[model samples]
Target: MNPTIKDVAKLANTSKSTVSRYLNGSPVKKETEEALKKAIKELNYHRNENARRLVRSKTQTIGIVVDSITNIFYPSIFRGIEEVAKEKGFNCVFYSMTSNKYKESYFQNLFFEGHVDGIIMISFSKRDKQELVEIAEAGFPAVVFGDSAGIPNIISVDVDNYYGIAELVRYLHRIGHEKIAYISGPEDAAATKCRLAGYLETIGQLGLKVNPSWIVTTDWSNEGGYHAMNQLLADGDFTAVVASNDETAIGALRAFQERGYHVPTNFSITGFDDITLASWVYPSLTTVKQPFMQMGMKAATELFRRMEHGEEYPSERHLLKPELIIRDSCRKISEPIATLK
Candidate 1:
């Protein structure tokens, strides 16, 4: 028969309540503790009834809420969080909103109902942040990803998007490509604003003309990118295009190919977020490498730290640097063509 609290308490010659508190890691008398240990060993018990009870009494799992699971970025981030959570013996439960307001609210209620220990929210909007603030103010632990607005006790992890986009634009200008176009993500997104600021800053520094027609914003979807690219191509005379993400870039690439436009030869293309598929696509992609996994891992680790210590080690924003990866997709205008002597 499996060992029970009654069996151990009887063997230790102590009240069940005392044994229960002792096994649950509560303070106990030195003499009673020794008796419990001896009784547990004599019974060859490998588990703690009190520990099980404690676990059952509360939900010790973390919640991860993301905008969309279809995006490659979210999955990579999820993997990072999962790895760290597993190492720390914590379980992760994910809820995808698919950018729906109602679903987001539903999950927020789940957290409030004691279904999770804490949460890591990705790609939250202003309204989402407001709701999250309410939860945080109520003393719930959470770490928000990619929000620039500073909230007390709410940890954040994001990339240096402005700098990353600036670097890409500057690189294009350095290669003598002056007529550049950009396909931006949702205008309301903080990341989109930062990246657009980078592009504008670089254009100004290089004394390049800004064409309003060249800047386009759309949902970060393949079809959105494809349609946006087609519109940009028709409206402007651009030699290169900068997409908000690899998916958009790939979509643009497909549009170009379908229209018989050669990548890097006829036009230069660059994408943000060096997703796995970026390199797999034909002609490969030149993009900014966002450390999605590292960001997620750090977010989870930081949340756990806060939970364990009741306060974060340091309450500050962590902005990770993004690197630009050069590939065949972007062309340099300086290349010399063979001329007859």
Candidate 2:
């Protein structure tokens, strides 16, 4: 009778899956690998062609897909992924898709071709949701760092954008600002939708008027925020502005400065992300701080779990908390002003 993997596992005093992982060149404990080797030699086990075909060798590499490398938010996440991968003796490969769905699909296919053991995607396009769902259904090891949309099968780690925005809005209201404007990010982004929803719901809950002109949309860029701020100034009057992220907030700050309007003094503005530049800039910035590095580490950890357990791993969603960092950008007001200019 042929010596099966079960026999090797029984002799090595480990799980059959552990023996299989050792044989497949996946990460296993050194002691377990040594025991498996000794057991295989003792059993004179020669892996048959069928067993070899059924068990594929792992590349011991993980692929990370991001929107853009130049974005300030991604480095910490990359660092987190790197730290975890190093501990597992795994390598990391990065793919910058520039928010393109086609590029995302292309890199995703690389995993099927055995280029990577798993993948972690950040800020994926909404249109790619179906594809992602399909991959998870097919038992691909993947974790996402954006809106999971309550999909039970897909693993994701995300900050509560709605809560963060709502908290910021409440803080602004407490500081005596009634007429607040919102500068949103791309419409398709999950964070944009959540943050915008928070803004709308909170404004309505606070009985503040939701001005049509006060809500403007822009991409996640400083230039986009600048142009959007300019448009807001032209359209209506508001006491304060709520930017989607730190970059936009900084850009809006520049716009206010260019027009000779002092932040918090003339108009109050707040941003999200609480990036490095948020503090370094003059006057600083009051924003919501998302756990970027922690999100990355959690996503990578989940991916490895999925990879190790395959379809047996339970689906999970890690919703991280956001911290509201109050700084020099906003001020207490006695009443809502009629206009900035």
Candidate 3:
């Protein structure tokens, strides 16, 4: 028969509660813990102590909700979360919303069904924000990424979207590109808004007029980028275009190539988020590097700290800086203009 907690307690000459306290690492005396460890090893006892503790407490599980699992960025983030969760002995359950309102709400309801100890939401819409406020108010631990609208007691992990894009814009300006266009992500996304602000600010600082027609908003998908680029190409002549993300940039690149437009020669293009595909693609896209894996690791670490300490970990708003990676995608406009003239 397998030895139980009681058997270990008996062997240690300690009460069940004392053994339990020691097992839980709850400030037991060193001598007592040593005795218990010896007793447990001698008896080869292994009890479902965690299960018993969970019956009276949380399940030690974390709920991760993301906009889309199909994206490479999300998978990298999930891998980071999984690594930290495993190290901390916590189980992680993931849900993909697929950017659908109904599915997002359904999963929100499921997460609230007491299966998880806390939640880490990758991105939330305005409507989702309202729902999440209610969830946080109800005393459930939750953290959101990319939106720092500041709800009470909710932690946020954000990127330096504005500065990142601003740097990209400056780089493009340095390359002598003045007639630039922007392909933006969904207007509803706070990150997208920040990026737009950066683009506009950079343009203004460089004494350039913002062409309203040059800015287009899309759904943050490859198709959206492709179509937006097509429309932009038809509407105007631009020396360069800044895409919201690598996926979109790559898509737009394919579209441009299909139409016999040589990247960096006919037009310069840049993207945000240096995803794996960005480097693999022809011309090797210039982009703003978001530390996706690090973001996930930070989020998971924060959640676990909250769980273990049983105290709010100073609800941080982490805005990590993004680096600009230069590549062949962007062209030097001055050189081309000089050659042409």
- What TM-score goes with each of the models? 0.73, 0.77, 0.73
CA displacement after TM-score superposition, residue 61 of candidate 2 (Å):
2.4
Ranking by TM-score: 2, 1, 3
| Number of the top-ranking candidate, with TM-score as the measure | 2
> How does each model score on lDDT?
0.78, 0.82, 0.77
31-59 per-residue lDDT for model 1 (tens digits): 77788899999998766555575532346
Instruction: Indicate whether candidate 1 or candidate 2 has the larger TM-score.
Output: 2
Tens-place lDDT per residue, model 2, 22-55, is 6665655566678888999999999888767756
The window of 10 residues in a row where model 2 has the poorest summed lDDT is 99-108
**Over the full model, what C-alpha lDDT does candidate 2 score relative to the true structure?**
0.82
Q: What is the lDDT, from 0 to 100, of the residue 309 in candidate 2?
A: 69
> TM-score of model 3 relative to the true fold?
0.73
Decide which is better by TM-score, 2 or 3: 2
Q: How would you encode candidate 3's per-residue C-alpha lDDT over 1-341 as one tens digit per residue?
A: 88877888888876665565455444344666788889999998776756455332456788898776565567778888889989978888987777545443355444334577777888734435566555444334567776856665567777789988899889999989898899998867678888999999999999988888899888877888889889898888788999988888988998898887888888999999888788989989999999888888888888776555432356667888898999989878876432322
Model 2: how far residue 325 lies from native, Å: 1.1
Winning candidate number (lDDT)? 2
